[model samples]
Each structure stands twice: as structure tokens, then as C-alpha cells.
Target: MTALPRNVPSSTDPHHLPGVRWLRSSYSTGANNCVETTRPAAGPWAGLLAVRDSKDPAGPALLFSPESWSGFTAAFH
Candidate 1:
């Protein structure tokens, strides 16, 4: 298996996946605390989850493989 790439660009990388729209959680509305997310347009990470802080759109993003994102969501639910 190939090693994952590091030092990805802040906005153009998974941190800001090109063409992948960002969305804020419905739970947020005029609140200081909110989470935003996006996903790849194609490839293995096509549907993988990319998360970041709403307060900092240009900040580093947390990439989670599809399965990992699902498990995280399930565990919290």
C-alpha cells in the first residue's frame, strides 16, 4: 500500500477539496460553535468525510475515511 500524502495545501487539499461544497451542521445557527464538512468529488475518498471548524474555513481539516466517519457518527448517536 502507498503511504498517505502529508502537508496537503490548507484550502486546496483535503482541507478544502476542490469543487466539494462545504456544509455546516444543522445543529448550528448563529452559534459560535459549529462544524463544517466536505467530501471528495471522485476516487477512493470520493465519499470520505472531510471535517473542519466553521470559525476557520482556511484551517486544517480532519480527514476521515468513509468507514471511520460512519463509525464516529454511530458512536456519537
Candidate 2:
């Protein structure tokens, strides 16, 4: 299993995270069923990747390290 990122912040609320611009996958269509990801450039959550459901922007997101995320997603391949 992959390791979690260091300094994981307590706030998982997507809106509360500062200066984040969520991005959707290029493979995503307008259906809004896929997930959105953002890399916080500043604040406590910076240096970690944040992901949230496309259907709920106001909902909480899960944070992951770049390596950890890759390990998690690699299972699909």
C-alpha cells in the first residue's frame, strides 16, 4: 500500500480549502459523475492533492499524496 502524505490537514471541506481550483479529467463528459481533483497551492492543505465528487462541490473531499494517489488508481489498470 502507498503511504499517506506528510502534514495532512484536518480540514477536508472543499470550500474551506484556500486558493484551490478543482479540475476534472479530460475524459469526463458533462454528466458530472466523475471526480474532481485539485492541488492546493497555498494554505494548510498545500502540497497534497484534493478530490471531490463532481455531483457535490460543497461536500468534503479526500486528500492524497501524489504517490499514494497513483498507487490507489493503479489498481484499475
Candidate 3:
């Protein structure tokens, strides 16, 4: 398990997060099914989930609560 960063701003607006470093699985090459995640180091949005597509950084992101993301990841396993 990894800890979310503490600097994310509380905005569903998606513009508050800057310098978001997205990472993709090594197995995701050439697939449209790519996903990425980032966390801020401090703010109201800290600890929130920022899920996005590797194909589109400027695209909309899916925000999730810690519990929600946990459940979501569990479902796949």
C-alpha cells in the first residue's frame, strides 16, 4: 500500500493540481486501457484519488475517496 501525497487542493475543478506525476504499468504498452495516478503533498484534496488515462493528461480525471478506491481495486483482484 502507498500513501497519498498531502498537497492536493480541494477542487473537483481539476486545475488546482500541478506537476502531477503520472505513472503507468509496464505491461500497459500499446493499450487503450492505460491508467495513471497521482497524489498531492498537502491540501483539502490530499489523500483523494486522482485517476486518469495515460493517453490523455488534459482529459477529465476520476476522483475517488480512499475507501472507494480500495473497494475498486479489490474488485479487480
Predicted structure 2: lDDT: 0.74
lDDT of 3 by residue, 1-77 (tens): 24432333333444566545666756687675788777655445567777777777666666677877787789888
Candidate 1 TM-score over all chains jointly = 0.71
- For this target, which candidate reaches the highest TM-score against the unseen true structure? 2
Candidate 1 regions off by >4 Å?
1-16, 43-45
TM-score of each: 0.71, 0.78, 0.65
Worst 10 residues of 1 by lDDT: 1-10
- lDDT at 9, model 2: 31
Regions of candidate 3 where Cα sits further than 4 Å from its true position: 1-15, 30-32
The per-candidate count of clashes, in order, stands at: 0, 0, 6
lDDT, ranked from best to worst: 2, 1, 3
The RMSD (Cα, Å) of candidate 2 is: 3.9
Better of 1 and 2 by TM-score: 2
Alpha carbon lDDT of each predicted model: 0.67, 0.74, 0.63
- The weakest ten consecutive residues by lDDT in model 2 span 6-15
lDDT tens digits by residue: candidate 1, 1-77: 12232223337554346667788999988674898887778644466677887888777777777666777778878
Which model is ahead, 1 or 2, in terms of lDDT? 2
Q: What are the clashing pairs of model 1?
A: none
| Candidate 2 residue pairs that clash | none
| Model 2 error, position 30 (Å) | 0.9
